[model samples]
Target: MAFDIYDFTSLTSSIHEGLATFLPPVGVLIAEWLLVGISVLLFVAVFGLILVYLERKVCALFQQRLGPMRVGKWGLLQTIADFIKLLMKELITPNKADKFLYNLAPFIVIIVTFMAIAAIPFAKGLQAIDFDIGVLYVSSVSSLGVIGVLLAGWSSNNKYSLIGAMRSGAQIISYELSVGMSLITMIILAGSMQISEIIQAQSTGWFIFTGHIPAVIAFIVFLIAGTAETNRGPFDLAEAESELTAGFHTEYSGIKFAFFFLAEYVNLFIVSAMATVLFLGGWMPFHVGSLDGFNAVMDFIPPIFWFFGKVMFVIFLIMWFKWTFPRLRIDQILTLEWKYLLPVNLLNILLMTLIVLMGWHF
Candidate 1:
C-alpha cells in the first residue's frame, strides 16, 4: 500500500477495535509498534542513501562532470561503496580527547537530522507526524545539530576543531534569526504553523506567488540563511580546508567522521526541503494564473515530483553558490549577518506584515 499520512491515527483507532475482538490486546499492540518502528527505520535508511547519491550527481552535473559511473549505472552505487568503506574503517580517538563525547557527537547530530524528517509532508497524507507546531518543531530540532558540532569540536581538543565549532555556533545563531523571520512570514500568511496546513494554504497558489514582493525577499533571505545554517558553500568557513583543516571533526576518523559528513548532507537536504515546503509549496503542482491547460498538465505529475523538483532546484542554487563564490573570512561572515542580512530580513518581515494586512496578495 502507498504511504498514508493518517496511518498512525487510523492504526490507533484500529488497535482500540482490535482490543474488543481479541483476548490478548498486548500482543497486537506490540506487533503494531514494531511494524511502525521498523517502517520508520527503513524509510530513513533508504532516504539517506538516495539523498546522498542525488546530491553527488547534482553537484557533479553543476561542475560539468559525471558524479558516479562505476558501482551501479552512472555511479549510483558510489554512496553504497562509501557506506561500506566507513563501516570497515577503524574508529579512532585522540589521546587527549574526551572519548565518550567524541563518539556520541555524530550520533547526536544524525538523530536530530532524522527527527526533523518526521514532520516533512512527502505527499498528501504522507507525513510521519502531523503536529500543530510543525514548523517551529523543525526549527527547534534543527538547531540541536550545532550542539553536536560543538561537542565534537571541543572534545577533539584541536585548535582548528575549536575554531570550527565556534564559527558553526555563531553562524547558526545568526542565520537562524533570518530563517525564523522568513518562516514567520509564511506562518502569518497561512495563519497556522502545521506543515500540512501550510501546504494547503498554497493549494490556490504558492506563497511565493501569493505573498509577492515581500515573499520573494523572504525567500532570498531564507535561502541565504539556510545555506549558512547548513554550513555549505561560501558560508562554509567552519570547514574551510585552507584555513581550519577540516573544521570541527578534524580529529575524528572512520565512522565518527562519516557521521559528521552524513549529518552535513542530511542538513542540506532538510534545508532545501524546508525551502520547498515554505515558499515553493510542498507537494503542490505549479500553476500559472488562469492557465487551465498548464495547471492540468502540472497536476498530472505526482505531488512528490513537484516537491522534489523544487527541492532540487534550491539545491542547485546552493551548489552554484558553493562553486562560484570565494569563501568569506570569519569576520566578514559575521559582518554580513549582523550588518546586512539581519537588517534586511527584519525590514522584509515588517513589509510582509503590512502586505498581509493590506490584503495585497493575489
Candidate 2:
C-alpha cells in the first residue's frame, strides 16, 4: 500500500484487524480508544513544552537576548527539566484550603480539555468522535473548564486566588458568546455542525473566503475572543502575576500544578484547532472551484499538511498577541467582550444570515 500521511484510518484499521485476530471485538475497540488517549496525552505534554519554549524565545527575541541556551542544545529540553523538577516538588495545600475541591480542581480542568479534544478532526477521517453536534459539543463542553477554575479559587481560601477565579469565570463566560456566534456564522454557510462536514463544505474554498466579509469579521472576532477564552496574555487578566500573583492556581504545586499548566497550553491548541476547522477549512487544501490544475497541485501537498499549516498559523497568531500586547485591565477585558465583540459578532451573524439567504456565497 502507498504511504498516505494525510489518512490514518487505513493504517489504524489494519492494526485493529491484526489485534482482532487475538482479541475480542470489545477489546479491540477499547484498545483503539486507549491508544488514542495515550497519544493525545503525549501530544499535550510535548506541545505544551514546545509552546513554553517558543513563547520564551519569542519574548527573548523581542528583548534582543538569547533564551534558554543552557540545558540541551539551545536549551530545547528546559521545559522537560522543569517538568521533572515539578514532579519532585512537594504538593502543598494551604492549611485553610478545602482539601477535596482543591485537589480535584486541576484534574477537572485537564479532563475537560481532553474531553473537548476528543471531538477535534485532525485530517481526513482522522477524528476520534464525530458527533452531529461536534462544533456545539466543543464550544459547550470546553467552557466547563471555568468551573474548575472557580472551584480552585473558592477552595483555595486565598483572596487573590478567589479574585482571579472570578475574573476568569466572567471573562470566559462573556467571550464564549462571541466565540459561538463567530462559529455559528461559519455553520450557517456550511449548513452543518459536524467538523468533517464543515471541512468538506470547504473543499473548493475555505469559509474565510466563501463567506467573504462576514467570514473575515467572524474569523477576526473568533481569534480575539478565543485568545481571551484561553486566558492568554493581553487577555490574561486571570493569571496576572502583577495583580493576582499566579492567579487561580497559585495554591497548587507539584503534579497538580503541572496539570493546570499543561491544560492551559492544551486549551490554546484546542481553540486554535477549532478555528482551523471552522474558518480555515480544517484539512482542506486551498483550491479555486473551477481551477483543476491549480487544485491538483494543492492536493498533491496532502490534506494533513494543509491542516497542520493552518492550525500552526492560528496558534502563531495567538502567540504573537500574547507577546506583543500588554495585559488588559479587568474592566477593559469585560468591556472588550460586552461592548465590542458581542455586538460586532451578533451583527456579523446577521449579515452572514442575509448573505446565505440571498444565495450570495460561492
| lDDT of every predicted structure (CA atoms) | 0.84, 0.90
Kindly list the per-residue Cα lDDT of model 2 for residues 280-323, writing each as its tens digit. Answer: 88989898878899888988887888887898899889988988
Q: Give every collision pair in model 1.
A: 5-125, 68-74, 68-75, 69-75
Candidate 1 has an lDDT of 0.84
The clash count for each model shown is 4, 0
The candidate maximizing lDDT is 2
Off by over 4 Å in 1: 1-37
- On the 0 to 100 scale, the lDDT of residue 358 in model 1 is 89
Q: What lDDT does candidate 1 reach at residue 337?
A: 85
> Once model 1 is optimally superposed onto the true structure by TM-score, how far is the C-alpha of residue 66 displaced, in angstroms?
3.7
**Model 2's lDDT to the true fold?**
0.90
